[model samples]
Target chain A: MANILGTNIISSLGFTTEENFQTVKSGISGVKHYDAGTFGLPEAFMASLIDKEKLNDSFSELSIKNSYTGLEKAAILSVFDANKQANIDLSSGKVLFIFSSTKGNVHLLENAVSEQVCLWYSAKQISRFFGNRNTPVVVSNACISGACAQIAAIRALESRKYDNAIVVGADFLSKFIISGFQSFKALSPELCKPFDKDRKGLNLGEAAATVIFGKQNNSRIQLKRGAIRNDANHISAPSRTGEGSYRALKNILQNIDKGQIAFINAHGTATPYNDAMETQAIVRAGLADVPVNSLKAFFGHTLGAAGVLESIILMKALYGNLVLKSLNFSKQNFENKINISTENHFSDKKYFIKLLSGFGGINAALLFEKR
Target chain B: MNFKNSAELTELYRSLQIYYPKFFKMDNLSKLGFLAAEHIFNACTDLQSAPDCTPITSRREPVEPREDIAVICFNRSASLDIDTQYQKTIQDNDNYFPSPSLFVYTLPNIAAGEIAIRNKFLGETSFYVTEEFDAGQMVETVENAFSDTSINAVLLAWIECFERKVEVFMCLVDRNSKKSCIFTEENLKYLAINIKFA
Candidate 1:
């Protein structure tokens, strides 16, 4: 069994995981409408952005400022803070680092600097910052990248090839990414409302989150099941039936009991198809009534970071017996009868599942339990 | 092996007898992966008689849909072709239209998805971007994939493409194998750099 030793979040709300989670539990949204002129678009869009000035200050306090890109700075600072929390010797060879992001250092293309924008180059630099000797594995599999990384970390620890692994997922918004969503009309001009009848679309956010997985050490949380599958339905949109997500959910549910599941953290991107697909998958997996929450309204579909960031919140929720509300949700839009948590509830549940489906017809599900 | 280097990607696609027209739509990264994985399936099926058969095009060797197999790939440049294309649309003032087609391939794992679709692999797929084709790291990563207990086979690949520099390497890891190439870094390096995978 691989224990979740530590977790951290660096988002628009605050630096630490506690700050981000508590602020969201209170129902304060960081997403705000920004003028199109901010990014040279024709219309305004809502996004949750990290304060650049504050980020620079935090970086300098930890390591150095202006030496790394905003992307690298965020990644480094998250891992640094997480390492301090876990008290793990990152410099040792017994540790593995897996960085998950759809885009890493690709924003550098905006400037004329022309630095190498390769994912491996950035991964090497980031892993070396923590003195990790083994080559870092960089996963760039669309938004499910974080789920994929966690599964890898669990597998690595279980394989006995490494004693511990740090799985981090991060993505910073760029005009290129924003425009892609705009092209697809996927971005909601207002805060996204997940699983609601009036939901418009998803809102993108910037964040970097780290989760440390260690060998059995009496840790309270453990990663139990991880499964990734493709829809083979469509490149950008799967069939409305949620075939891939169902397969992933079913694969994870094979060894898990329905009663033991405390709650489910779903990837409710709030788009027309994404949420419908997830709810359908949940019902198909026979988890229609189990409490479900989507943190995208709080963190704004943080892309790659959504899986780990939201999982960390669920971990804390399981620990504190707090089932946070699915923010911005009012009515049910999905045909499946899922109990989307609209109000905060308290319970001592042992198990939780995280389900995430992304672009490229990919779906990933992870099962975790609180000891 | 019909294709030796990444430069032969275009010619390699032409040489293969695959019916999937989507092969023409993918970026160079996806093309490299589809073709490299094609080579591995060709070997696994032992389709030596299917003259110059790439994995995707060769139908002589019928293999069942194996959920036991996992896909793990490594590369330095993740989707540079599509990245360059998407960046081109946004970087300049005149040619600023972020085509969703190009934007979709911006992440490197789309290649893995293409292969999974063609092969019907429902297992876990991981795209690892590394500084280089470090065999030790690849070996370790492959072993970790097998630790899941349910995974008995793995489609290990190092399909890298950047600025016309193509280095496609794929190895099929069988958990029950007792051969000399028992999923080791040295053996991966050997198959990656020298000789066609038998």
Candidate 2:
């Protein structure tokens, strides 16, 4: 089995995995409020905007910020940080780079410079940083892009293809993405309250997360199984019956014992439809009683980075033997009751499930085991 | 649903007698993917032979249906044609209204969703944006999609549209094929560029 050797998160709260994990664990949120000037909104909106000064400060330490785009800077720095901790030689040809991003360098679209708007160019440039030999694989399955990348890496590793896989997901909030969400009327005016009765909508955030997996055991966490299911229900709205997500959960839970699952890290975007669908899905899968939580309250919805960053946090939570609190979860919102942890809880079990559903009626569920 | 190379995709729709109203609302990229998928599915499954028409989802029955086919797609310019349209909506200072119709098709994966829904492929579907048609990356990703034991076949599509030109190559990869050619980068590139391959 491939083991996650190293992980790092470049989020609003902090730059390193340990730093962001500790900040969120301490019940401190990184989400801040900004008005009309930001993203050109007519009204105010809440988002987990990464502190530019803090990022610039940390990036200057690496002294390589100027050469790359803002999104690329975050990704390269996070992967570099993970490599620094794990001592993985990214330059080695034995490593396979799998990059995930919904919209990379898309901010260039405002200038009408259509030539550079391609995600392929951005992916190639990022991989060149490590002097990697193999052509990198870019997954663009909307929000599930990151989780899909890890699954792809696991599959490639099982084929005895590459020695290690550097799975990095990054997306920056440009006027393009923010305006699109605003047009959908999916952005919450206040801090997102996931799994709450008063939950209005989601807040978009930008982040980059990295996980290094090797065949040899170096880290405690192991990815057991993953499944991606399409709803075939609608383009943007998830199935009200949770058909797609339920199927994904059912596929991953086939051989595994339900009792072994300690907690579930849900997508919980705080959007009415998404939150409701997740509730029905968890309950339908018979995982309703499990301690379920969402990290959007801490970092908001980081789009492409949500899956990878949340998975990294899950590894940290499982390694630390704690169920990270689902911040802003106060009241039950759905007809099917779910166990959303209001406060941080302790658990002895070593396995957990990660769930994410995206715009293209896509749903993904992954099972993780810690040794 | 016969497969053939035609510059006029509308002619295929007329020939097939396809009447899905949503097809008209779709952008050129999605229309290309939808048509390519329609032709491939008809060929892979005996659509013409079976008059009653058993869905592709049920044709591979008794072995479970959902994970039977994984849709893997790649593109060069992505949704460049539709993106230009969407950009114009928000670009105009007086209009300032972003048309949700155009906004939805901006991502290339929406075309993949259209294919999955129409074909009823419940398994994994991922879209990769490539600068150019790189056969190596497409072949490697297809191998990864087949890792799941339940994934019996992969509908690999290389759909791209930029300016007025559109190129779509949809190949059905099933291990149960009697006359199936070897799955390789060279074979894919040859088949993609050349429309007619028996």
lDDT of each: 0.80, 0.81
Q: Is the docking of candidate 1 incorrect, acceptable, medium or high quality?
A: medium
How well is each residue in A1-371 modelled by candidate 2, as lDDT tens digits? 46888889998888899999999899998899887767654556788877777777777788744767778878888998998767878888888888898877777766775666787777777788879977888888888988888888898788787889999999888667777787888989888999899999998888999999888776778988898888876778888988878988998898788888889999999999999999999999998889999999899888888889999998899988899899987898577999998888899787899999997788999899988
What is the number of backbone collisions in each predicted candidate, taken in the order shown? 1, 0
Please list the residue runs of candidate 1 whose C-alpha ends up more than 4 Å from where it truly belongs after superposition: A112-116, B1-11, B46-66, B178-181, B195-198
Encode model 1's per-residue lDDT on B1-76: one tens digit a residue.
3444546667787777666788878888888788877767766654221233223334545444545667877787
Every candidate's DockQ is 0.54, 0.54
- Tell me how far candidate 2 lies from the true structure as C-alpha RMSD in angstroms: 3.7
TM-score of each: 0.92, 0.93
lDDT of 1 by residue, A1-371 (tens): 57988889999888889999889889888888889766666557899888889989888898753667887888888988887778989889999888888887777777642545777677767888887877788888889989998988887877777898988888898887888888888989789999889889999999999998898577888888788877755668864778778888888888677988889999998998888889889998999989998998888978888888889888888988888899998898555679989898997978899999887778999998887
Q: Which stretch of 10 consecutive residues in model 2 chain B shows the poorest summed lDDT?
A: B46-55
Chain A TM-scores, candidates in order:
0.97, 0.97
Error of 2 at A71 (Å): 0.7
